[model samples]
Structure formats: C-alpha cells, structure tokens
Target: MISHFVNRKRELERLEREWKNVPSFVVVYGRRRIGKTRLLVEFSKNKNTFFHTFFEGTKESHIKALRKELAEFFSDEIFLSLNDYYTIFRYLADKIDAKTLIVLDEFTYALKGDKELASKLQRAWDHHLSKKPVMLVVSGSLIGMMRDEVLSYSSPLYGRRTAGFMLRPLGLFDSLELFENFEYGIRTYMLLGGIPSYLIVASKYRSIKELLKWEFLTPEGFFYDEPYILLSQELRELKLYFSILSAIAVGKTRISEIGNHIGVEARKLYPYLENLIRLGFVKREVPVIGKKNKGVYKLNDPMLLTWFSMIYPHKTEIETGVIDIENLRDELKKVMALRFEEVAKEFLVEINKRERLPFKFERIGRWWRKGEEIDLIALNEKERKALFVEVKWKDLNEREAKRILRDLELKAELVGLNGWEKFYGLVAKKVDDKKELSEEGFSVWDLADFKRFISLRGEV
Candidate 1:
C-alpha cells in the first residue's frame, strides 16, 4: 500500500477554509486513482465526519450501505432503518446537535444506479441539510457524470456548491519526491505524468526496462489494461477513440492524417476529438505564433501516450512473450524526447514564476511554420519580448551547443518578432559549458539545473 501522502497542500488549505463556514457544499472530482479519495481522507481527520463510499449497486443497496455507515458513526440505531435519502436527511437534521461533515465518495455510483438521485439529494439539501451546521461533500471519478450531475448548469446542485474543483495530477517538481533522483524521476514522469499511484508502483523498480517488463509489457501487468478501463469509463465508441489515440501516438497529429490512419473522413472526427479533449485525454495544439486554424491533436494524458505509443502497437508480440526490451529502446527514447520538451517547458514556467528568467512571459508553447520548428517560445506580449528555446534530449559540448544556439538565432528571425527584444536559449539533458553559455547571455539549462531548482524549492 502507498502510505505516503506526497503533496496536496493547496487542496487541503481550500478544504480547511471551507470547513470554517457552516453549511458548505463542496464538490471534488477527477480521473480515477488521481488521489481524490486520499485527499478527502486526509482532510477528514479529527472531525465529526461521516464518510461513505458508494459502489455499483441498486439504489436500495446504496441507501442501506449509507445507513449502516451513518448508524455506526452516530452510534444511533435510528439511521439504520431510514431507507430513503430525504428521510435520512430529515432524521439527521432532527438528531444532530453540533456541526458535522457528510462525505459521499464515489457518489456517481449512486447517481448511476438512480437517475433521480441528484434531485433527491438536492431536495434533501434544500429542505433540511442546507440549514444545518453541516458540510456536505460529494466526490467521484466519473468525470462526465460528475460534471453533468453535479457541476454543470443543468445540474440540480450546480449553483448550490460553495466551491468545486477538478484535482489535477501533480507537477514535475512535486512528483520528484517519490523517486530517488532526477533521472528516475524524469523518466518515470515521462511515462506516468505525476499520477501518485502509478508513481508509487514505479518507485519500487530500479530501472525503466525492468519497470516496463513487470508493469506494462505482459498481459497480467498492472497497467496493461489501464487505458482501456479509463477510456471505457468516460467514453463510448471505444474502438474509434483507441484508434484516434494510437494514430496520434505514432505522429499522425493533423486531423486529416489521423482520419487517414483510422480510415475515417476528417470532418467526421471533430466530435470524437472534442469529446476526448473535454475529458482531458487529448489536447489540440497550434503554433504559438501562427494561425488559429492550424491545430494538431496530441494525447494529453501521459499514461495513454505511453500505452498507445509503446504498448498498444506491439501487443501481439508482447503477448506471445517474444518481444525484446532492447528492440523498443529507440522508440522509447523518441517518446521520452517528446516528453522532455514538455518537462523543459514546465521548468521554464517554474523559473518564470520566481522571475528567474529574463522577463515574465505571458504565454509559452511550441512554434512551427512549414518544415522549421522551434521547440519552445515564451512571449510577453505587452512588453513585446520573446524567448526562443531549443530543447534537446542529448548531451552537447560547448562547440555543439553554440552551433545549436546560432541556428536558433536564425530561426528567431523567421518568427517575425523583428522589433521585439528577442532572447535565445537551450534546454537539454546535458550541456558541457553551461557557465560559458550563461555568460554569453544565453539561458541554458540541463538536468543539473533541474536538480538544483528542485532542491532549492524543497525536499525531494
């Protein structure tokens, strides 16, 4: 079991603030295994709390389970016999004498089992629970259902919530705490993208190859079927979505290219792509300094990216136990390279947060026009200053580093920020003469900078 609670200070502070106010309704939600339950549990300590986890079952069974939990918490036999939501709320309102917390975790299962469950809870809250000194929290992992049934405008409980937020995965800095050092941390982050449970499993392994073999390559591996489960939870048309993800994973990024790869017309893919985007699976990216219509899709979820890129395409060979880890090393390196660019961007953003960079950039993203591409561009539109950065996944000596930076200066001209205060930089795994590059007014960083920044930030 993963016993350590890594970092959710902001979330805990938010919950604690709400705890001070009486009659607060809070909604917490996210993708499964993203630590929603654990956060709630951590927040619920040493209070008059009643926490119940609803499973997939009929409405009657759900009520029975809730009643049993409530009866145990309150040490009152009355709750055990109350079989309906409204009546139960009424009884709690009548019997309670002090402030209390009622947490409904996996509450979507109840909503799934009973279509009228939200309305019933709404009615209960309006008539009885809302006036009491109680804080009601409902959380679930079904993102679509949670939004529609709780957070959406059409939902009965929409305007009633005092606060609501979708808990996202940890950032690279925070996630580094789970690993031994920067190499293991960055490599694991490239594959898992800061999910706590997955990182816990990953922290147990010594090398990337061993981790992949034990947890991903075989049919019985923990993550072998994970993407399928996640997709099936929030989406229909699984086969089509899988195809789209796989297509994007292998570098078919344009809408037309993905359609061609999946044997579907480009126009017909918008809805599926939109749904994926809405659910946080895929993201559409356009050049930071280009036309709005020039968007290309990429898998936003890192686990899915790893799955489709490294596992899904080679499933047949993997299942037959004939696949060699060495054979996939090159492809894995490519995936890691792409992911490293994202990490580099994240590092720059963190640096910008503390004004460690030359100027505060308002926005940053990849920039490309035709065949030429810059790995990253940070823009301060108001100041008209721009930073062009090239990210590499390889080690470069002083001569090679200067060559890449000179080429970056050339590409900077094509960006059309001629009058803007343009700056050039590089980020890579290793750079031989960072001090020299820095002295030349270039922003250069390698893994050493990553470790230094992380160490200064806090424990890791």
Candidate 2:
C-alpha cells in the first residue's frame, strides 16, 4: 500500500530549532513501531548527516560496521583499524569541522552489547564532541533501557541533553488519513491504533476484519507474535506481564479483579502495574466525581488489548486451524462500541481545539459515581462551566436522542455542580435531526457532523 507522511509539525519544528543551535544533544525515544526512526530520518533530510542504525549483534561486530561506515564517509581507511567507540567518537569529533547531524538509531542495542557504551559516549561528548558544532541525535525503541542508560539521573549522559522528545502514537485526527469513513477511522483508532506501521499495514486492507485475518488470525501473520516480541524487549518476566495484561484486557478493570484473575494480592501487583503504566501498556484512572479512592486500570495500547482479548486467549484454537473469523467479527461489534467512546472523546477534543464547543473546556474525561456513568464531560472548573455529554455508538432516532439528553441533565445534577453553568451534548453514530436538537438549545453531534467539522477544519 502507498504510504505518506502525515504530520509531525511540533516535533519537526523542535528539531529545526535544535539544528540552529550548535553543540546540541537530543534524545528521542518511544515504543517500537512508533516511527522514532522515521522521524529521525525526516529530520535529517537536507543536512550533513551521519546516520547509523544499531541492530542485534555483538559490540565488536557493530563497532566494525560503524568503522566501515565512517571509513567510507571520510574516504579514509584509517578508521578501519579503530578498535572501540571511544576512539571512533574522538576521530569523528576531531574530523568534523562543519555542522552535522549524527543519528544513532536504536542505540539501545549497542548498550545491550556493551554496558560501557553510554559512559564512553559521555566521555566523547565531554572531551571532544561537545566542543564541535555537531547535533547529536540518539533514538531508541526500548523505553526502559533508554531511560536508565541515557536519561536517568545517575547515567553518564544525564543532564547533558539539550532536549528530549518522547514520541507517542498519532492522535485520532492524524490517523484518519488511513481510512475512508469516520466510522472506519474510529474503529481503526480503537483497534490497530495510530501507530504508523500499523496504519500503513491497515491502509493496505479494506476493513478491520481483513486486516485482522492477514495480520493477526493466522499463525504466521505479521502480528501473530507481536505481543510476545513487545513483551520480551522491555520486560523480564514474560508470563507475569502476559497474565496481568490478559486479565486487564478481559473486563478486569479493578485492581482486586485483576489480582483475583492472576491469583495475586492487590498490593503485590503494584510493581507490575506501575511498570506497565510506565511502559504505556496500561493506564490507571480515577473517577472524576470521587477521586479519593476508587480507580481502575485498563490496557492503553489498542493493538495489545485486541491481541490479549482475542488472539492470545484463543491461540491454541487459531494454531489448530479451527478459529472462525466470522465469530470474531460478531464479537468485534461490542468491542468497537467501547472504542467508539474513546474516539468520541477524542473528537470532542479536536473540536475543542478549534474552539467549536459551547465554552472552552480545560478538561474532558469520563465521570462515574457508584453505578452512574457519563461517557464524556468537558469542564472548566475555574469558569464553573461544564458540558455534559453522552456518547452512543449506534444510530439514534430523535425520540431516543431526547431521552438520552434528559437522562444526561439528571446525571449532571448528580455530578454535584450546583453553581456550574452546564450545557448538554449527545454524540451518536447517527442522530436524527441533530440540527433541530442543536437549535433546541442543546449541543448535539453525530458522526456526519463530526466528519464534516473535521473536514472543514482540514484535519481529515
């Protein structure tokens, strides 16, 4: 499938500004397949660049390869005999006279091969490279290793970096370019997510079912072992992490429920849960109404959530060739509904960015009280203004929409905003006579309205 670079305006702008500053050291990191390498390559364009991608190998082998690259770049066989990275770094620092960009992509692999590489690089920076006009860019996929080795307070390179950017998956609006419909885009955002590699593979497929068949359902599919690989890269105890993630994926949101599922106590799971949260795989959230005690945990990565919820649980069935894609398709509708709520929240944020909401809200999130839940609430506590919203993923007729709005008003009262100036909104797949509802003094939106608003703002 044809793929095009969508947008990284903020990152690109930051890198451009760094390029103007001499003797800059920048650290760029993110999870694997999140486009860290692509971003570095994009930033290195039209500049004097020395780009080296460290792969799985021994330190001697990688150093030899790096020596060859340097020898070729400088047209000198002198670099051929260089033994270590320190000497190589000194050579580079001494040779380069002009502004240059040096990108060490996947630098974690080199660190894995040799633990001393970070200190060596730190020495090189202090004694040689820092005196030059070189802009050093180090990028890594292993978040934990990169943080400990390059960014932690105790590391040799600590306090030396001029800037650091942690790249995240693209947002819903940026990901819409991969799909033809708002519905499809929302579904994709909830499933494969906004990771560019996943989106590129998705753009080749016609639908989520097809994408799953090609990349997940089959034993030899690209994503069949993705969770295993991802877990192995950053984690030590694979089985424990897998169990925790599986429990979280299968409707076990509370800490107690997850602990029960994994046969562990709630307090004992904090380390694993905290690590997962740090890795961006799981998220911990508290209710908006009562933030004192009640909280829940959920899988943050859509791809991982889908794998644990579907493919991982049924791995034996899939491997034995008895898996039914149609059955999975039937279940996907329910899964898509939960994801639609997330997309609806993102949609509101996008419109909020355009100042299209009733009043600008500083916070938008799901609020819950006992058994009562509001899908989306945008509020500005300082101004005492709140927008209460209900997100429905199904088509809603005018009567059904009005009933939901009425229920929302009651729910808003339960939110305990006595003096707040409140507004009501309903987001649905299809809201019959949404304009009429909007004219009736409530802010109402449907998929078509959301699509049109996004298109008008040049976001799609």
Candidate 3:
C-alpha cells in the first residue's frame, strides 16, 4: 500500500505545538477519506495516548466501547463497568497526572447516536477534564455535523476548543510523491484531486486506463458508486443534489444554467449550492476583477467532477458490462484540459511563494467579462500590477507560443486595466523555445519547469 503519511509535516508540527500546551481541546475535521484518522495516529506515536474510534451505535454502546478501551489502557477494572461520560472524564482527570493525549476519532458518530453527547462532553470537560494536563483531540468526517455539533457558536462546546482546523486534501507538490512518473502523477491528480486514500489506490495501478477499468468502470469497483455513497452520507434530497452536481460537472456554471438544467428555479438553488460549498463539494467563483455578485459555480471535488463527466454520462453502458475505454478517451482528455488550468494556477502559486514571479500577487483567479476570458490573472492591487496568462493543454512550438501570448496581451487590454502594469504569459503542456520566450519578457512555463520544481523540492 502507498504511504498516506508522506506530506503531513505541517499538520504534525501543529499537533506538536498543541501538545506542548496542556489542557488543549483540538478539533480536527474534514470530509470522509481525507485522512484525519491517519494524521492523528501519526501524531499519537510515542506519546501516552488513549485512542478510540466511535461507531454508529447506541449511546450506551459507545460508552461501553470507550470504557472497554480505557479499561485496557489504564489497567483499571473500574473503567470497564463505568456507564457514563462524566465519570470517565472525571477518572481520566484524576488518573492522568502526566501529559497525555486522548483522541476520539469519528466523534460525530457518537454524537449522532446521542443528541446530547456534545452537551454531555461539554459538562464533562468543564467539570472534570479542564484542569488536567491532557490534550483532548476529537476528529470527525461529517463536515456539516461536525460544524453544527462541535464548531458552531450555537454548539455547547463553542469557545472551548484550544485549536481547530479542517484538514484539506494534499496539494499538487505533495501529491507528486505518490507516483514515479510526473506526467502520470498529474493525470492521477486530475482524476482524484489528492485525497490520500484515493491516491494510494490509484498509485497501485500501472496506468490511468487500467485504473479506471477496474476501479471506476465496473459496478463491483471501489469507486463506481463512491459519489452516490458520499452524497447519501451527508445530504438529504439526494436526487436534487445529484442533479445539481451533474449539471455543474457538465458546465452549467451559472445559477440560471444549473437551475434550468436541473429543472429548478434559480433562486431556490442558493441554499443547496451553499450547503455543497460549505461541505467542500462545490465552489463559486467570480472574476478576479469583476462584480462580486456575478459568480458561477463549479464542482470543487475532482472525484465528483470525473464521475459526472466520465462515468455518470455512461452509467447505463457500464452497468450493463459494456466498458468502452476508447469512447471515453475524448471525455477524459476534456476533463484533463479543464483540470490542467487548475494545475497551472497551482504551479504559479508555488512559484509566487518562492518570490520567483515578476511581483508577488495578492490574488489569483480566472478573469472574464462578456465572452473574452483569460485563463488566469494574478493581481497585486496595492502595486497596481496584473499578470494575465493563457493556459493550454497542448505542445506548442515557438510560433504557437507567441501567438498565444499575443492573444493574451490583446485580451489583457480588454480587461480595462489601462494604468496597471500589465504583463502577459503562457502556460502549456510543452512549449518549444521557452527560453527565447522568457528572454522576450513573457512569464513562460511548461512541463519541464514543473518537473524541475518537483525535483528541486525533493518531492519526486
């Protein structure tokens, strides 16, 4: 199995810092399969830890399971018979004289099993666990439940946490560690979007085509029904949400477009779209230099994007055992091309971090008005400077590269940044004579630069 623990140094360091501060209540939450439990397990190494995972069962069952685990850890027969949360916390507060880590993974499961679990934990922490030199870490996979029951201001545990953060999926640079070939790594990233568990499974396959056939195209495949399962876990009105996602995945970006496609009124989609945005499944974007109210929605999760684009459209044939790889090739390429723009943006962000860009951009995003659009625009508003770029998923010779750059400049002029220091650039899969283009004062980059950057960072 691929190591899912490769790129969590920063998260580990944060946990270490929290460990140094006793009586810490740390809340770590994210979507399912984003590796919250793995991160906590890594942090618990060599420490005095009592780790227990809660399940979807009765409150008494949850208490009994935790008590059993604690009974073994503390070697105290009394804990085995303990029937309540308060007494457990009271016992820990009294027994844990030294620094200790107490991790409650999937705490939301227990919370759902008992509606008053959060309030009960709040009472336990306030009356018993607060004075102890313990770091109590609780993590959950259900984003909406976690926020409502633990992190929201209306929650009983509000203002009680010492630290909290949503664990995000791995970025491009860190995700490259999973594959030997840079090109394949990019493709896998486009398909899976850096979720560690998914990347681990993807890494085991020889090629994307093979991986898709066995893991995605077949009904018995691991990912064939993944999106359905994921949606069912955290959402009600499954059909509407599925239709909304399907619409966005197929390029119905505007609220009007999505609503029309899904056969709902535009205004009614706001709540559903907001929920998806909050759950990290969909994202809304406005032009970097345009009216804020003019926003468009897109599928934020790469897996869902791939599923809706490639699998959902061909679901009938696949379910009937007709797996046509060749027929799906063009669709996959289209998805890759769309995702390559995002990859290009990520590359520029990394470069900006190292101060390698012409000037440090305060914001970066796609820019458009009317029909003319730029693939990316990096702006340093304080300095009144903008960098406009056109991204392509093709191998471009010098002439083609210059033509793109020229078109980019023309588009930049239409953006109405007349007084701003405007610079033009091009990014592509491959660009011949990149050095010559760079010498001509264009910010040029290709796959070679990406490879070099990964190698230099020692991530390969």
lDDT per residue as tens, model 2, 106-137 = 99999999999999999999999999999999
Clashing pairs in 3: none
Per-model C-alpha lDDT, please? Answer: 0.90, 0.88, 0.90
Q: Give each prediction's root-mean-square deviation over alpha carbons.
A: 1.5, 1.6, 1.5
lDDT of 3 by residue, 195-280 (tens): 99998888888789988999999998889999988888899999999999999988899999998998999999999999999999
Tens digit of lDDT per residue, candidate 1, span 76-137? 99898788887887887777779998899999999988888888889888888988999889
Error of 3 at 169 (Å): 0.7
**What is the model-wide C-alpha lDDT for candidate 2?**
0.88
C-alpha-based local distance difference test score of model 3: 0.90
